[model samples]
Target: MTIEITGSAQWEAWQAKVLPPVERVADGLWSIPVPIPDNPLRYVLVYALECREGLVLVDAGWDDDVSWQALTDGIRTIGAHITDVRAVLVTHHHPDHLGLAGRVREASGAWVALHTLDAAVARPGLSPEERSEDIRSHLELHGIPGDEARRTVDLLDVGRALQSPAPDVLLEDGEEIRLPGLELKTIWTPGHSPGHSCFYQPDRRLLFSGDHVLPRITPQIAVYSQTAGDPLADFLRSLERLETFEVDEVLPAHEYRFGRLDRRLADMTRHHIERLAELRAAARETPGRTAWELSARLAWSRPWESFDATSRRFAMAETIAHLVLLENRGELRRGADRPVRWYPAATI
Candidate 1:
């Protein structure tokens, strides 16, 4: 059978400007588009699954008054109310996916569920200074200069406002959610984030991929101080995991739903392989360089100098992920320095 990308045409048309209309995707599934402020991706698709008791939302859109209103309005269109939402299943702690979760719980007394690892990050207890310090330390370790690292921390602080409420239920990998009327199993795909999860309904052959897989763009996978292991490796493995599923359709958080899971997975895998080779070649040319410097030399969607603080930080992290992978594979080595440097295993 020829695999195909399937989703509401209207939703695909309004990529980043106007919000797409709330769409009934499946028998009990509804797709609601909520806008993300100043983001090129435009909006998140909050999937609401109807149940015996009320409704269970796969992910909540960004936390803001506009998003809140949009969510409520979208719910109303489905003959339901925000208060009818019984649970919010957060894919990860990213603001766009988990932002309004706390607010939803406040209004509806809904239980918010997240993977234990991400729950730690989303839980609200850290002081602003503490968060800032963590960010600063992580960036500095990745070879970012002190001042620039501090500035990046400040930029990241803006996202703190969108942190979701503490998770009421911590989900585990391969665990089936006990929703009254649905059978959704969590797949732990930890690359985009330590505990990023995708929900699969085996009966329906539907996968609710939250940034783990997107229809168009390859989800950003980067290394951070908080990251447990080689994120690039984890990302590649997660892509392979998709092949095990006989998915008829995919419902992603950012982009329109699509079929051909195997094809997209191959594309994502090839992307990283090419990125790894590029980094390896760059390492050969510049014998001993920090990830930060190497990142500046790599090709990005935009010029390195044109990137804002957050974008630069993400790019640096991505470079580091690739570097670490290369080092682990014996293609590169890390030098002993305060801000560690990477060198080709075989000197040019």
Candidate 2:
């Protein structure tokens, strides 16, 4: 269950109290703080790129006065104003990524560009037909009750009401986007989200990795909908593909930006494999058990306890996804009851 924060003004209140003053981290890039209270993951990073055509913003942060101010001031630090922004590129549809998109567009008249797949999720103001029922089905298959599943879906509204206009440009995988002075290639990296794309600059050997690959933590991979294929498997394959690219430094959405891309990629790849092993061991001892039961066995951060329904749903979906991955790899197996999945260490 989500720990609901009561007060309509709380989101804005926390933003004003915690948003850090804007600072430029690179010649053409800036880091704007977006603070979230009652959660450990507290900040969002906004990258601003100035080109002859104008500015290209990667990831629109939270929709709030503080967040807007932080972004606007950060842009001004490089001698550019919000009105100078030419276009916005969304890494994904998550609230933190698309929050200020509308405001940015309104202020600068910038056209928004996002992957078509992710755009579907950011559209929450529509009727039931617009939303995917597959998300609910995925949760139910993992043994989450109807009421809990419904509540989780409802919490998606937390950010929906704040969504900006749909993308002015629909991005496709493998498309090369050239905005006057910038050359960015869209690399389709599913798993985190169906159509999540990472922007890569071949000449600079730089990667703008949204939530695809973080500096410190693993991006949550789960079955949110009747999403195509195995998400965890897709993620592993995506990591392998990323190693093929020559990324000298990665600019992630959270945490500090760093160099040595291969090592960081290796670290991320190893984490999931090791996690799969741990899940295998845990399930071996318990054998026939439900996904929910196994989820309780795993350790989560203390701060996660206060996360809302959307967060909890992500946690549970990720847990089930790992278990399913192991099962698919012959490391574990599911029984007739569906919920009764068993992990036999000997099988591995």
| Top-TM-score candidate index | 1
In model 1, which regions exceed 4 Å deviation?
Answer: 1-3, 124-126, 158-163, 346-348
TM-score of 2: 0.81
Using lDDT, give the best candidate's number: 1
Q: What lDDT score goes with residue 79 in model 1? A: 98
RMSD of each candidate relative to the true structure:
2.2, 7.0
For every model in order, what is the number of clashing pairs?
0, 0
Which clashing pairs does model 1 show?
none
Write down the TM-score of every candidate: 0.94, 0.81
Tens-place lDDT per residue, model 1, 1-348, is: 233768856445655457777889989899998888888888899999999999999999888899889999999999999999999999998988988998999999999999998887566476677667877887887678999998888776544642556789999999889878878999999889888999999999999999999888889899876676788888899888889989999999986888989888988888898988888888888877888889999988879989988899989989998988888898899888767888887763
lDDT of 2 at 182: 80
C-alpha lDDT (0 to 100) for residue 1 of candidate 2: 15
**Candidate 2 lDDT, 180-218, residue by residue in tens:** 778899998988987788999897787889998876678
Pairs that collide, model 2: none
